[model samples]
Target: MEDIAEAAAYGVAAPSAASSGAVRRPAAAPVAAGAPPGMAAAPAAPAPPMAGGLAAAAPPSAPRTAPPAEAAPVMGGVLQKEALGLVEIVPFRGVRRTMARHMAESVAKQAQVTTMDEADVTIIKRIREKERTVAAERGVRLTYLAFAIKACTAALKRFPRLNAVLKESGEEFVLKRYYNIGIAIDTKSGLVVPNIKAADTKSIFEIAAEIVDLVDRAEQRHLGVDELHGGTFTITNYGAIGGVYATPVINYPEVAILGMGRVRELPVVHEGKVLTRLLLPLSLTFDHQLIDGAEAARFLNLVMSYLEDPDLLLLEGA
Candidate 1:
């Protein structure tokens, strides 16, 4: 029984009472220093007693085998977590690397500034609701992006500087007569922005259909290299992903980029009475070197006015 108890204390299975009482417990092995807690090896057995019951000291020539109380913060500590799992590594591809470098260079070179304002899109939403059947009959989806693109093109026409590009040599600001707006599309391959060529001439329904086609092609990685360039201005709708507002980086060679945030209903004052209004957050980031804050604010105000009353879009002959 005593031998069985001793064996049990040493983590060994105990022998049955009917078995021999001469069972012996093996000496515990020495644990290395720095091992994780609860995983350290057991200490070596104590030296046996000699003639007068004094423990015999180990020989001077014998090497010490006892582990330290704490590990030295080396291999054993690192291996402790290895018992679980490790992170997988992925290599960076050319497209993603080029995007990273371009974005970094844009930030480094451009004199960037961002201005934000919220537009009351209640009227536009109501108009879309009323025209839903007509749009469906025309086989087009009347999205906020279409309205935004329409409004943006009109604002760019009124404020051409916002749609222009600055020369790298600082020779002159080249104002573009053509209006091509780039829509930033997030795809599985990467982010691709394919602009609507001569977007100013397209109607709201036409813009909607084109947007759908461009987004589909971008996601499927079927867009041509030419479609990726020649954008005068860019617009990215972070609203689709529930983003409120973000300072989007300018596509270099283009003077500005606009970000649309998620629309939410909030109480607003109208005619001295509080009313719930659907507000769309707008963030316009531009090159501060070429455009001033006042001009940018005016451009934003124009876009907001057009959005607030979408009828002005047709009235402007846009």
Candidate 2:
């Protein structure tokens, strides 16, 4: 019975000895009834003296390993949304040298001298006098440009081809549909023609406002790309510089350009006697490709009529 008891105890201790490679036995004597068959025995209470030495000799474990690289890349719709929301501004070099050369050549190579015409702007002048005061009260200064733009709009309706451009593709002229009126402004750098789009649709007040805004921006050297392109007709106000008349250059590709000269008091024969009246010099340069002398003369007559009877422009729903 004693030998069997010792054998059973050794069997229960086998797994612990295999796992840890250590042997332990309680100091107390073994019980006769060994642990039941096929049931795990409580581990032997370790021998006390060597237990502390075993725990202290073990090395500290390394940290856990990272996951494998085969996992998918993280993606979302936010990146695509950011790319689509960006705005782009395209900048290009301008043909300013050509424009400058043409302007200088126009002044020097004028075939015909400037023409002078006297317009009785008495009624229009009076209306301006009244409007200027009202405009001043509202912090706006009304200039003759408002009246001129309005008169030009009415005259253009009478002569639509005057607003046309001359395109020479295989010896033919192509007239365009839209009417864009360019106003020539002499900036500190040079001259620039920033046109007003759809001039016929705007009122006199609106045209005046646009001119003022554009001229202000131009002087500041802040004109945008759109302002420097696309013109069908042009007006150069040389009157501000005291020029009586000037054969202004035809802004290229356009059929006609009008020049306004200084308004001065001059002696004119009304009936038989000489009378002092306000007179303005006018010059018109037209492309011979599309406009004939007769047509040009008629267009000038229309413009003169509008200027002479500026009140008619107001009454004509300008």
Instruction: Judging by lDDT against the true structure, name the best candidate.
Output: 1
For model 1, the local distance difference test gives 0.79
**Candidate that scores best on TM-score:** 1
Model 1 CA lDDT for position 123: 89
For model 2, how many clashes? Answer: 0
249 Cα displacement, candidate 1 (Å): 0.7
lDDT of 2 by residue, 1-318 (tens): 432232233213211111111222333432223555335446545444456465333345355443233222122111111356523232211234446565565444333223345465555666667787676665455555556666676777777777765344535556656667889888654567888888878866677778888888876766665666688788888898778777788777666788888878778886698987777677888765566677778877777778777767667775
- Clashes per prediction? 2, 0
What's model 2's overall lDDT?
0.63
* Per-residue lDDT over 13-66 for candidate 1, one digit per residue giving the tens place of the 0 to 100 score: 222212122222444455445556446456667999999999999766445565
TM-score of each: 0.74, 0.63
- Poorest 10 consecutive residues of model 1 by lDDT? 11-20
Between which residue pairs do clashes occur in model 2? none
- For candidate 2, report its TM-score: 0.63
Off by over 4 Å in 1: 1-88
